[model samples]
Every structure is written in C-alpha cells, then in structure tokens.
Target: MKKIRIFIIDDHKLFVEGISSLLSDDPRFEIVGHALSGNELLSKFTELDLDIFLIDINMPEISGVELTRQIKKLNPKANILALTMYDDYSYVEKMIKSGAAGYVLKSANLSELSKAIEIVASGKKYFGEEIQEMVYNKISGKAAFDDKRPSMNELSLTKREIEILSLIVQEYTTQQIAEKLFISERTVETHRKNIFSKTKVKSAIGLSKFAFQHGIIDFK
Candidate 1:
C-alpha cells in the first residue's frame, strides 16, 4: 500500500512531537518532516516531498494563513490542512482562502485528525463539525440583507437551486445531498456549479455565507 507523506508545522515542539509519534504508528501515513516555524519549513522545502501539511494558524511569525499562501506558491497542488485551536469564522475563511483544503481543531481526536488527512489527501475538503457549526452560527446571526436588499426575483435562484443551497448550508456532502434528493451525484454537482456561478462564490464555505445572507436557509 502506498502511504501518504505528511509534514507538520507548528510553533510548539511538544505538539509537533506528539503528532509525529501518533502518526508514525499509522500504516497509512508516513511522517516525512516537521518544522517549528514557517521559516524552518521553507528553508527545507526542497528536501521534502509531502502529500499533506498540518498547519497551526497561530505562530510567532509567518502565521499559518501566510504560510499557506507561500506553500501554495511553492507548489500550487499542495494539500494544506489547518490544525489549530481557533474556531473563529474569520480564521477559517482566511485559511480556506489561503488554499487550505481542510480545517480541524487541535482538540480533535485521532480518528478525526486521520480522517481529515485522508480527505484532504484525496483532494476533498473537510471542515470538522465544530468548525462547521461555528461558521453556521456566525452566518446565522447576520441579517440576510443590508441597505441594498436584493429582490428575490433579482437573485434568480430556482426552486431546486434553493433546495441544494439549503442542504449545502446544513453541511451535507454532495453525495449525501444526492441521496437525499433522489438524484445522481453528478446532477447535484451540476447544481452546485450553477449555484456558485449565480452566487459568484468559489467554495462551499462561501456558499454557506451567501445562503445565510440571502435567507436561503432558516436557523433552527
């Protein structure tokens, strides 16, 4: 079996060592390298081949957000995952925009951490339940419209599009949404493409923000 090569970056040595020890035992993951700072990681960039990078958002210098942007510049295809204690929506948004494939709290269990690595390594996005909830709550509290209220007719979202947006806001994966709506996953993806085009957002996280801002989904 081919093992996924992993690199960890954080300011805390103990956290780095602990994660190294934990993942060293997992057959599916190979710890290729680790760094205590973004500068350290960049210095040895040419020396390591990594499939996934576990990054801490809060660092003394070159914060995870900036590091993620640099890493993407080094290798645009790199799969970056933010593993930190921060649950704030701004942090999550910034990290995602910086090219991170996933975000999970440091307090996450071994299973969730491993799952996040697998998901991101496979080119899929993963946001832990807690992170998702934090985003949902943050979006929910804001009014759907500002002084310039977009008329429903101007928004031009079809009924099916609205349904898919609601499911997306509820944190349903494309496959799950397909199953729930009794449609092919490809069809669901097509709808998502349309939704993004109509909303002018690039990611699911962006979609959630748009959904809340347009009152596409109700808070419960």
Candidate 2:
C-alpha cells in the first residue's frame, strides 16, 4: 500500500512538531513537509506532492479558509483537511465552503485524527464529533441567529423526528441517542432513516446544509 503523504501548515511550532512526531512512526503516513504560514507553504508548494494538507484555521497571515481556496486554485485536486482549535460554526462553514475535505479539532485523540486523515485522503469528508455538535448547536438556535425565516413545516416532520434530527445533527451516535432518550438503538436508526428520507439528504453534513437553507436551522 502507498503511504499517504501529508503536509502540516500551522503557525504553532509545538503543534506542528507534535503532529509530525505522532504520525512519523506510522507506516501508513509520510510527513512530506510543514510550514508556519500560508505564504510559506505556497512558496514551497511545488516541491511537495501531498495526499492531504492538515491546516490550522486560525493563522496569523492567511486564514485556513483562504489558504484552502488558494491551495485549491493551485491544485484543484488537493485534499485539504482542517485541524484547528476553533469550534465555531462560522469557521467550520467557511472551511467547508472553501473546499476542505474534513474538519478535526486539536483536542481530538490520535486515533480520531488519524481516522480523519485516512478518511479525507480516501475522498470522503470527516467532521469531528465535537465539531459536529458545535455545528448542530449553532444551527439549532443554541447560538442566536437573527434570521426570522419560517419554520420547517413543509416536510411535515413530527416532533419526535425533529428531536431526532437535532440529535443527529449534533453527531450523536444511534446508541448514544438511544441511551439519552431512553429508546432502543434500532428505534433511533429508524428515526434516522425517516429523517433522511424526509429531508432528502444522504449524510449528516447534507442534512445540516438542508436544515440551514430550509429554516429548520439558522446560521448567522
């Protein structure tokens, strides 16, 4: 199997070194290069052939979102994954919109971080559980949004379905939701299937986008 080549771009040297040391021993990954700023990365861009970019969203020079945009422009097939401390939905949304393949928090365990890298490298999206919860809370009005759009009634979602949807958006596993709601995991799965059908979304992120666009959840 070919090892995944990864580049780290973060202003924090300790963070960069920590990640490099963590992944350096893994036979599946190769740490190609790293940089302290977006401009630094761009300057050395042509020298590295990276399978994934682990980017910090809150950078001093260019934000990760903008760096993602520029990187995508430089190499449209670039697989970018955000590794950041920010849990704000605005940062998450911006990174996604800017063409990030995944978002993982700095607080994530090594296993989760490795899983995110592999998932994104395999052409899939990954959002850390905490990040998903952040998005869910923001969209569900746990964080205030000034938009007064009408409620999501056209879907005719039952109260139970809405409750389940919120939990799903919050990245709660079926087992976790079941345990929390005093229901069976199978029942939670059933609700999830129904929610998918009703919302016409195949993934949690898709459901999130639909929720934001359809006034089921608010952003801003």
Candidate 3:
C-alpha cells in the first residue's frame, strides 16, 4: 500500500522532531515535509502533494487556523488535522470552522495521533475525547460558538471578501488565493485583514466559525 503523504506546520522544533520521529516509524505514513510557520508552509506548497497536513494551532506570524484557511484555498480536498495543546471549545470550534477534519491535543499518545491522521486521511472527522466534549457542549447549547454571528450579507463584506472567505474556510493560502483570483499577494492579504476586522475575528478559525454558524458557505 502507498504510504500516506503527510506534511507538518509547527513552530516548536523539539515537538516537530519528536512527532517526526514517531511518524517516521509508521509504515502507513510518509513525511513529505515540515515547516515552522504558515509563511514557510505557503512557500513550499508546490513542493508537496500532501495527503494530509498536521498543523499546530499556535505559531508565530500566522496561527494554524489561518494556515488551514490558506491551505484549503490552494487545495480544497486537502485534509487538515490540527495538532495543538488546546482542548478548549474555542480552539475546537475555530479549527473545525477553518476546514480541519479534526483537532488532536499534543498530549495525546502516539497511537491517538496515528488514529487521527488515519481518520482524517480517510476524509472523516476525529476529535480527541477531550475536544469532543467541547463540541458536544456547543451543540447542546451549554456554550456558544460565538457571541454575534453575522450572516454573509449582513457582515457588509464586499463580494470579493465573501469569495475569499469561502476559500479561506477551505484552507487556501494567500498565494493560492492570489493565483486563483488573479490578484497580487498584497491584495489577498489586504482582503483577509479586512475580513478579519469586519468579522471581528482575531484568527482564521474565528472567522471560519462565524462564517459556518452564519451560513455563509453551503459546503457540501
């Protein structure tokens, strides 16, 4: 069987090395590449035809949530599994909204990470038990996804912003977005910043969650 082609994006060198070592020994996975930030991952997008991406939630420059958005834009079919230490609902909600198939806490055993990778690679959702609890709590209305979710039209975003936000939810990077829309990288960044401000979101995950909760994209 062909090994699953996987890439990773995280800032912690020690963590990346440890995770890489763990994944290297697995016959089912192939480490295609790794990067320390969203910018680096975007720079190497063309070099990797990844079957899945293991993205950290927190990183310098751009967070994993934003990275997921950018990745989805480049390859809508890309399977993203957030690798993070956060088990809070905010993290779970944001990642899911950013088009991640699941969220895996860094504290999880190696077996758990493998399971998460396998599940996401197969196009299924796999939230760690601790994270699942938050998902459940949100669905049960014990906690809210966001305070004020705005509908796409009500958000007052330009048509281009809507188009870009849709792709961001799909994990498209700024470069991919530029190529897709025939715009410059700076233009894409400008639009993204505007989207963030208009949506009152601090990260890609927050905007994605707001978009989903507000029915901005009819994702099938």
Candidate 4:
C-alpha cells in the first residue's frame, strides 16, 4: 500500500512536533514536510508533491481556511484535513466552506485522526462527531433533543464525559445522573472528575460557562 504523503501547516512548534512524533512511526503516512505558516507552505508547496495537508485554523501569516482556498485553487484535487483545538462551529463551517475535505478536533484520538486523513485522502468528507452535532443543532434548535439537555458539540470530551457534562449543566446531582444513567455513583464521580480535568474547570458553573463560551453547549 502506498503511504499517504502529508504536509503540516501550523505556527505552533509544539503542535507540529507532537503530530510529527505521533505519525513518524505510522506506516500509513509519510510526513513530507511542515511549515509554520500558510505563507511558508505556499513557498514550499510547488516544490514537493504531497497528497494530504494537516492544517491549523490560526497561523502567523495566513489561516488554514485561506490556505485551503488557495490550495484548491492551485491543485483542485488536493486533500486537506483541518486539525485544531477550536471546535467552534464557525471554524468548522469556515474550514469546510473554504475547501477542507475534513474538520477534526485536536482532541481526537490518534485512530480517529488517522481515519479522517484516510477518508479525506480517499476523496470523501469527514466531519468530526462534534461538527455533525453542531450542524444538526444549528439547523434545528432543540428539535430532536431529549429532556432539554443541551447537545455537546466538541470531541475534547469523550462521549461518556460529554453526557456527564450535559447532565452537570442541567443541574443534575452526580448521584442523580448516575442513577438516571444506570451507573454507580462512583463511576459518575470518576467521569465528573475527568470532565473537570479535561475542561480545566474547578466547578460545574465554571464548566458550563466555559462550554458556553466555546459554543460547546447552548443554554437555550
């Protein structure tokens, strides 16, 4: 099998280093090159032939969205996958509309991220779970909701953790949520702690506020 050639465009040295380290040992992908900004990528774009691009939304001199547009203009068949920390629907929509084949959160596990690259390389769209939920909620406000629980719109939290966070926002006591979900309070407490750790919050109120600010959950 031919390895997918991937070029990364991001200004954060840690992000570039981390991704490179993660993929270097993988057999399915070949890291052809990397650039700290879209401008840098543009300068090196024509010099190397690559199949996929791992792009970040924010950069020093040009954004991944604009870069994706320019890339498509230059090579209409190029596959681009957005990798970022922002799970804001606006960012995802912007990247998608700008020509990214996939929009994945930086929080996604290695397997999920790799699968997105593979799908995009195969000429298919890969919208992360949070992205899909955001689209659904935007198009239909609370239409398919159950019991008025807000939809969790970011993969930064695992599915189970998101469920716990949603319940937390709904003011459900950890015990109540555990009982409702048919799990032990101990399990719920563990998930609650994990949610707090992942979200960097010390309390439920702070978590709710943080989620609201990031568009991870809506109050309506």
CA RMSD, predictions in order: 16.7, 14.4, 14.8, 11.3
User: In lDDT terms, which candidate is top?
Assistant: 1
* Runs off by more than 4 Å, candidate 2: 143-220
TM-score of 4: 0.64
Given candidate 3, what's the lDDT at residue 158? 86
What's model 4's lDDT at 184?
98
Per-model CA lDDT versus the true structure: 0.81, 0.79, 0.79, 0.76
Count of backbone collisions in candidate 2: 0
Which regions in candidate 3 have their CA more than 4 angstroms from the true location? 138-220
Candidate 1 accuracy as TM-score: 0.64
- Clashing residue pairs, backbone N/CA/C < 3 A, model 1: none
What's the lDDT for candidate 3?
A: 0.79
Clashes of each: 0, 0, 12, 0
Q: Model 3 residue 49 lDDT?
A: 81
Worst 10 residues of 4 by lDDT: 142-151
For residues 71-150, write the lDDT of model 4, one tens digit per residue: 99999899999987676768888988889989977655677788899999899999877667767887787443222223
Winner of 3 and 4 under lDDT: 3
**Candidate 4: Cα lDDT at 121:** 86
